[model samples]
Target: MSFINKMLPNVSLIWPDVWQATLETLYMTIVSAIIAGILGLALGVWLVVTDQNGITPHPVTYNILDKLVNIFRSIPFVILLTVIYPLTKAIVGTSIGNTAALVPLVVGTIPFYARQVQTALVQVDPGVIEAAQAMGASNVDIIFRVYLREGLPDLIRVSVLTLISLIGLTAMAGAVGAGGLGNLAVSIGYQRYQSDVTIVAMLIILVMVFLVQGIGDWLTRRTTHV
Candidate 1:
């Protein structure tokens, strides 16, 4: 179409950089997702096991972790990035690249994913959990076989949500020179007054998001029995 042709001229000029930025975005997203998935699942299991009537009640520990999750989740990503700049620099030896962007991505996502994991785990049938316990199943067995198994669909759904959120955060990270599509949009498009470039970058991001969502939904539907 005429519209696309008009955009293509501008988009072609920045295609290589956009591709690189997209790769960086994917790297940050996938790495952080793996880390958050492991840690958040552990945190969620702990939260479930320590609540008032859980298998092993420990109000103090639960309270501490709960507060910690809330505190991290409440902080805006921009502020969190600035606040953790020193740690980022120390860890990555520079605070202005794709690798350095992982710090805030992980920090911002862990609490969010943990909360999602908790909600998903909590939705598992209480009767199923009780039955597992009544059968002399160990706590570990109950958590893995009962809780996680039953919550798989919801977990996938929420993981999708978390991944999508991470994309947005990566864009914000770009503002600080993380060099992703966000940076492409801001530095090349907005700052340079190239509306066409901005639009293309946004479209690419939107396409990526929709792809993620579609895959997540398919997985959820396939895994879910009810």
Candidate 2:
């Protein structure tokens, strides 16, 4: 105990705050990731299914969704926080807390996850899809049993990637007003010259990222038969 304190001299002072911040960060990341994942999956599937080469080609629909995804994905997250401030405030009734941070987090992640989903789905063998169709499979059946099933491994990989990215964004959210490790590190740690605090916060984040990655790899391997 004494030796640990000697190393992170200031951590004990704000240990409670650090713990709270960790919870807040997890809350924002998990909630937002879930919402974004569902929405992004829908959008992604739409993109694949409505494309020129899709099961139901609709060039107009594909172009519009494609452009929207590109536009949102290209925006810097920091700028996105500001750009969507009004929407955040309107929806959550405030724009400076962990809950409020969820709006932008979901918005920012959706397009990115959507693109990842699209990529994974596209990698599903076209020949396999054709076979399913020839076997009198409905579009819905092909989507569920073939596209999603075969692409499960890649989807899991991309989901891990998105989750890790969302965790980083939660840190950035802390810089502005979201109460998380990022806020603790930047607002109290860095600004107050508490180097130990900054290090602790960063270490926690790294652990979180690694855990997500490890779990993702295990799931991918388990699902991947071929």
Best by TM-score: 2
lDDT of 2 by residue, 1-226 (tens): 8898899889987889999999999999999998999999999999999988789999999999999999999999999999999999999999999999999999999999999999999999999999999999999999999999999999999999999999999999999989999999999899999999999999999999999999999999999986
lDDT of 1 at 51: 84
Model 2 Cα shift for residue 76 (angstroms): 0.6
Give the lDDT of residue 34 in candidate 1.
90
Best by lDDT: 2
Q: Candidate 1 at 38: error in angstroms?
A: 1.4
Worst 10 residues of 2 by lDDT: 5-14
What digit string (tens of lDDT, one per residue) describes model 1 on residues 1-226? 5676675777776678879988888888788789877888888788888988678889999999999999999999999999999999999999888889998889889899989988888889899989999999999898889988999999999999998998888888887798888998899889988888888878888988999999999999999996
lDDT of 2 at 167: 98
Error of 2 at 220 (Å): 0.7
lDDT of each: 0.88, 0.96
Alpha-carbon shift of residue 116 in model 2 (angstroms): 0.5
